[model samples]
Target: MKKITIGICSIGSGVGQSVVDSCKFFREKVSLIGLGNNPLAYGAFDCDKYAIIPSYYDDQYIIEIEKIIKKHEIQILIPGHDDEALLLAKNHEKLTNIGVKVLSSPYELVLICRHKSTYAENFHEAANYFVKTYKAIDIKDEFFPLIAKPEQGFASKGIEIITTRDDLEKIEFEPGYIYQEIAVPRGQDPSYNAFIKQLRKGNNLQVSEISLQLLFDRNSDLVEHCATYNTLKGGVPIEIQPYTTTELSGFIKAITSSLKRLKAFGPINIQGRITDHGFKAFEINPRFTGITGLRAKLGFNEVEFCIFTLIYSIKIKKLKLSNKYLGIRQVASKKVLQSRVISIKKEDSVQKNILLTGSTGMIGSYLLKQLSDQGHSVSRLYTQEKELIDNKKGYSITDLKSGKINLSNFDTIVHLGFARPNSTDSEIHSSIVNSFELATQAAQSAVDQFIFISSQSVYGFTSNGKFTEDCKTNPQNNYARAKVTVEDHIKSITKLSNETRFTVLRLASVIAPFDSNLSHEAYSSMIVSLLKNKTITLSTPNRLISKIDFHDAVDAIDHFTNYSSSSVYEVVNIAPNKNFSLLETMKTVAQELGKTEDMILTESIENEEPNNLVISAEKAEQQYDWKSKTSLNKTAKYFKKHLGY
Candidate 1:
């Protein structure tokens, strides 16, 4: 069977959410389209497709609804609010002409139900069950302890309880107010009396209430009815149970007969409280109520029955009701990360907001300074509590993972934090997991560009010649394996996002001997040995190594931050134009430090195969128009100047 396309309006309201929830059961038989005035409506997020339209009171509301219905090819439209229901009922012919069926009662019936005075005057069959109501202008002093309600309102808004003459005199007589007798008599029920006594003592308590839901077919024949006794907390039903008594059954039978006489169709909800005078209805809603979805849990779904009978022309003989469980309502929450609205600006706009992780580390520290010097707004991310650097505030990684941090304000995120090779197994594991989590959050938050500082060690120590970014990874150590894991995870997670661009930079060994913040084992070991001992030994002196200047690595990252492309995921190797042997690199450093060649010695270990590490940066050069400019000799000179040897 072809799925019915149904559209629901006013999705920001409680009834709208309930209708959406009820429709979920027949998802295979229908396609749902949610329409809301607010952008963050919960029901909007739950639908297959949704659109924001004008308010029901707006002049363009009907036109917008028509457009949306035609766009989505909607065959049925359900009104979610009383006012919306009345408006749609008034334009029944206009909507029907466009091949759409509106699930609503007649306009006259809706208007009578909306106005309390009108309902009391027209609903003669249920006169004994309805509380005596009067116009606000005709209320007298004898009508003390009466409840004043808005003539046209739902959800119990604008209700005032006038218990004394003084209370009545002090209230302003609004134009659209109706006065009705309170359902609970002054001293009749002990439960109501006790509740009143506690309320007088400044303690609020829940009120016992009941609701009778009636469903009718297109021909005004009563199809099903459900009676529920519930408790209200702050005008909302918190606990409810299927309830029926000898007296209540009689009341329902009379009301159903009266509604059928009046040609009532679709869903109708009557709300009241049981008093000594019997069940007194204070209000009647001519459409679905907020508990409609809750009713589905008991297998008495009025929505499904109405759709099948009215829209599909299929008769529903009976509804299967469940009394095995009670329905409890609680507060539920959903997190919605709206897409960031970026202002239109020139391409060369300065002052980009950047978030930097591992801000105190070697590459991060240098990158932070460079970005700040370029007039970019930079925020540092710290794993633990630390002192402020340059009076800049630090954000916690915990906050990012927990969604406490709003990443929409940032244009770029540079993640350089990682555990060193010497770290414990647990620490390394934590770092790897945190890195993936950060990437996932970044993608979900819709950050513009996410640059992950990966290591070329992911290629391992097996390649003897130069390798490009397309080479397969062969990790030889736990650290290299962790880097590959992060790379793969970032690519997979970011592929789902259209707003975030993920760039993975696999950097070669970075040489920054002049900076004390450097802690990598390879460069640190070589420098420490050359400075402390007159003779330095190398096991694999001829082993080739690919290294990039610290400034060049930082520059490469800056290049990608400003780069834009159609590709959402990218991986680029960052290395120098030339590769050198370990012996040649140490010799250059010794020469720069004014040491003779005799100070450096080479030794070969027996039965050991030489392994070389080399990577090509042709992708970065071709795509980013960038290359490593600083040579090894220039880096060595900086070391000599700092060491004063």
Candidate 2:
């Protein structure tokens, strides 16, 4: 099936975001193009393609939209703001002429709905339920404790409550402002009074605010309607539940009649309170509301129904709604990085001054050589005076501990120094102390970035499912515990500083061909057993393990050090996409060395199941575009050549 291309305007507004959320339900059938005046609009990152266009008030707004429509071959355009909707409604002919359907009401009806006083006057069937509106100049003492609002606004902006004549005299009256009786009268109902009192005290409590949505077909006949009792904070619904009342049913019928009289079609939203006299409507929006997405989750998907009915001419007979669950809302964020204009053709394309610890360690030695060869200025941090004698750019660990090293001189810090897995308690404690001090100083100096190399053992090596970065840490040993402690400390110290970015790369077991300086303990031991004994044995042959190539580990460090643009703070796993069991790995080694499978042996335990230590590198791929390129079979070949097998 061909996907329908849809365009959304005012992508930063709540309504625009709601429409974007609704489109996800039909993602396989539709393509979204987000349009906004600001490039940094939140919806820009959510859509398939985004374009910055002129504001709705601009003369070139329609022309720009038309160009985008022709370029992307858009079939439908949905307006996200009230003012923008009205503008689109006025230019409905221009859009429809270009083979695009504008999802909005007629221009005449939108005008009445956009203006507060006009809406109140035109909806005569619900006239008795409309809040009494008074002009600022015509206000009297009897209208005390009235709510003043802008004649044209959304999200409760420019609104105030006037409790006394003195309060009214203190402010200047604007031309486009209207005063109305408070929707909820004081002392009317205990629950309503309590809600208002808490609101006055600025408490975040769930209070009732009823909203109704009416869907109309192409013929301007109301076909379906639903209502939600909502609780709002900062003009956004935080919680919603299905609600119905005798007064609400009558109000919906009356408003349906009013909408038919005014020839309003498509989606219309009505908001008000259940007051002493019944349901009084204070606001009417001619387009979808923020809760439209929430309604879709509850199975009352008006957006889908309207599109099928208006565009495809499909008739939807029954309105299905599920009220068994409550809807809750929370804020979500997405990071947008500035695009890089310069192509990184070589490792030296973008140079950064780096301060590196653990210069003699397995991964650190390779990383140090790579950084220096790439033309980056590298300064090594040594734990002993003897290690610093030959290098002029080297500083002792005492220099770091005593504040003798000026950390601000370096743009980035990579800490890979740690005690070995079998180290004593005191040695591990000392190592942790040094790392904490370094992180504290780095944050204090406002370094641009800090990269810490941790281990996958922090996940506790469970036997079950694969572990993503979000899995809870269950450090089972001293080494894993120390890593978690240091990770927490680094995150805490860097939390308040926006200038410093801290990244924790939880690395899996590293494997490579045998080399005195480069070989890791596990890989070296395996190679030695295979060469000397001409056979290998495993107690738990089915145990799954995660390993990365040595060169790939070095590349990951380099990528995060310079190329990652928007990672303020993150913790991601560094592992290969493939998984291999202990027995399979040994067999691959034997095959590379011209040995048969009979040379491999396993002692299976009676009831012991094999444990898994598989790590997920999905976040690294998605966030930094980093992945392992070297295969395990290739590493086995390298081992064959290194050992002369």
Candidate 3:
């Protein structure tokens, strides 16, 4: 089984602990990364690996989380507390950009559940079994012996019994404070009279409250519900049993159906008491209950079910219930090692706003997708008048030479649109004019940097063994000359404008899927032909080529864009160090596709083959600490699945 990293925030909380405990059962398949604001949170130590993060209210909270997600490559992030859950749900778009799946209720539903007053106002009828609830300000002619608690209070915190109107008057009525009619608990059906007698005599003050744990999917459809007869100790469920009554179960099902309209997801806990009249609900917690671990140990595992269903798209079979299933909770402690306390500080990193050109081009398109996935705000610049559909936010510059493009909102302008083949002298001049104009506009505007994508062709054909960034440029063709001209233009802009920095990246041949604007490359072409059951014929079998994967190309751009440097200008070469000959690459692709080397027609191959040019990225690695990490084995496997080879 493939292992995936899963992060649980506020893991010290009850809900987070439950999730961590459940993840332990799937240790073979899941790597749990626990996070908490407090060092004392037990879940932090209980998880496979733990870290102490700032509170959700902290300004650096999301930034730290993004760093952790990137470092650990966390695929799913589960918020354990109500506030964190709501926060994660609110910033779903931001987190999902990094491929992190957040399982949480909708923001609206979270609001309804976080405050008792809101839940009572919006869902009173559907939850009629609940205690008679009223806002403190709206408690007009209500009877005495009312229960008052904070509207957004968790557990039994901030609860007070109001026996007289004078008592209510003496207490300040804050917006978050609400009043409710108390419903005395009654015993089970057969022992109801005896329990009431004992309660009246003060001999027994037991409040028989049962907690109903409900599970829902992303679509807000209820998957299952478990009824636990809870024995509370200081507002915490201590002893629990899988107990259910027909009347109580019916009421819970109705409530679940009503909540489904809110698109509420994950586990929801409904706490209520059994009274002489009937089962009366007190409040609803739109999250995993405190008894989740106990319940999982007994029969059902909601965390596992939810993860499997949501992440893997696997359907879970209905869990078999057992009334005899029982579990107990006790105070358990683990001696903490003082050295394990990890203190986290905010790193010095700023968010970037990128203006990317040639978004419709092959490389640019991939770069745009990758940037967006990494939570960077990138705006696409188009030269033609294209309708912006699917809510793509960008600007269209019909005339780039006019210099009407807006560079005010962007911090970096990346130019990848200058390369145009089969153009006349006039068209070439127009492209050059447009490229220079755009660079000038960027340098003059508030933009901090201008990144020009140049080609390694600027080096011409290197006579030496390898070409480095320090090598003098010797343009051999129109395309190479055009790239060099743009590079020089950008350098001149940097000299004139002291505020803006300039960077030039001379990229080698990239091995990636060719889009409509891109030409078929040797690597991808060989793979595609193999998938189509076609043979490849090469006149020269020993033509060497140095190629970088498309992903690594994106990595190079990301590194420089995010690199905070004091230098005014820098030029770097970007390419893989490994080199492969045409025949060797063809045989590898064929082997990966389970085809024989005979599939490649090498009969016409000449004994002598041309040597390939080489470029080194040592400057990029030393200056920006950037290196391309691509394996031919992995790339081949990716192409097999990506192109159905």
Candidate 4:
């Protein structure tokens, strides 16, 4: 059977992530793609593959998404945010023509459900149950100690309680602001004191808050209603338990039935309180609530059933409730980084399933060895899963041109591989940029850290005395330009994840064993001249050069892997403190090879180039407590042995 590809936007949001998680119910039959603005968003990492798009508000947002859909062949495109849902719904026709279904309610109904005030006016059955709503101008007959919130807001933003006439005086009433009678908590409840405390913290005070999620068919007929007793923190449900109330359920059906003409096609959430009179629904969201994951664990799994039914064109089945009452409680976590090398808390650290890319390259080979020597459980991400010794641990790009790839089950992502596109112009952007973006998408997953091996070439050809992390980048060549692109992309992705750290090390040219493919200019010249007894010409023998041994590069990586700090992002220049002139460097290598005068050098010419193009490693030395331990002489000797000189 052909895979049914589904793509979801805002995948980092709790609501969006729940939708992605639901696809796991279908296993291999479902190929999930996550799209979002932030690279560090947890949802970006959770999907089978993902792409980055502009912010939903950006004009290009839909355009970019449309491109992703056509490229990935996505059959269904699900928007996870309320505003995004509206955006997609508004563009449903255009997208549908391209063979993509916007898995959301009709645009008209989405408008009705999005604006809270509109829902009450349209559904009279639940109007009386709604708290009396009034604009500031309608305050003539309204009472004090009322609640005020955005008329069309989601997630309880801009909510305030007016306890006195004086409090009301301070508010500059806006058109979208709605005022209503405050819902007080019941004194009889066991947690009444806690509720009062929470209310004092400026939260909406209510005796009982409930979430009624109703799934509607494409024709707008109600298919299923799942209710949950909710405990909220920061407007997000932290604890939830399945509940059944006949009166509330019937009332919800009546409310939704009134909107038959809306023709909503997916999930609708009603958030309100049960009061002395009856059930009062103050707000309604036209999309999945943030507690969707909690509800799934309790057996509803609306996201799964909804997507499955829509994709298969099957009739919606009555939801089966768990025989035993199910409940879920969420815990929060925070990340902290510090100066100097520090051990990560065992509980906080992802010490298992470390993911490594660029394993086939020079530094990657040594890194693999170092990780193994330290007894780490490591996995390799390969371009081809078949090339991996353990295919289960590998991640592969579905399509490079489209930047589609699934990423999961890793603690950290070390990105070292880069596409060396031969083209030095815009023509190479697609392939080169796609590699970085795909890696970023992979890092957005649950990985705690993303380490990218950047190059000092990003600084281009700086004529300054020395460079630092603060140096302004002026990319000169296509390779350097690509590196800068990756750096910026990585920064954007990691910004979304406060708990994850992104480290970019701008390394000096590396001196490694002679391999035409991997060796830098200086190392290659030294090896070729010594082995073939050929002359090594220099424009100016007095010109100074700074190079790091391959081993030092490995050591620097080890420092980063072990160092823990409070910062979520850091960039450091990796270079030796000392510099070597061309003549001195050539003599050192020749002496190490015991070649002496056998390795010839052409006469030097007058040149105006600076003696040094090195960067300062002060920050690396102070913060990471590490620096180059090998001298240029030692590097030459090590290379001589490795090169079989």
Error of 2 at 175 (Å): 1.9
Estimate the TM-score for candidate 3.
0.51
Poorly placed runs, candidate 3 (over 4 Å): 137-142, 187-208, 336-339, 343-645
TM-score for all predictions? Answer: 0.53, 0.53, 0.51, 0.53
lDDT of each: 0.77, 0.78, 0.72, 0.69
Between candidates 2 and 3, name the one with more favorable TM-score.
2
Regions of model 4 farther than 4 Å from truth: 140-142, 185-203, 206-208, 315-318, 323-325, 332-645
**Per-candidate total of colliding backbone pairs:** 0, 0, 2, 9
**Model 3 C-alpha lDDT per residue in residues 158-215, reported as the tens digit of each score:** 7776666776876544556778876676645444565456544423333356888888
Instruction: State the TM-score for model 4.
Output: 0.53
lDDT of 3 at 34: 85
- Per-residue CA lDDT of model 1 for 515-547, tens digit only, reads 443555566457545665567787788888788
RMSD of 3: 23.0
lDDT of 4 by residue, 220-317 (tens): 78877778778766776766767786758668767776656567678888887766566777887778877776666667778777777755665545
Question: How far in Å is the alpha carbon of 152 misplaced in model 4?
Answer: 1.9
By lDDT, the best candidate is 2
What's the alpha carbon RMSD for model 1? Answer: 13.7
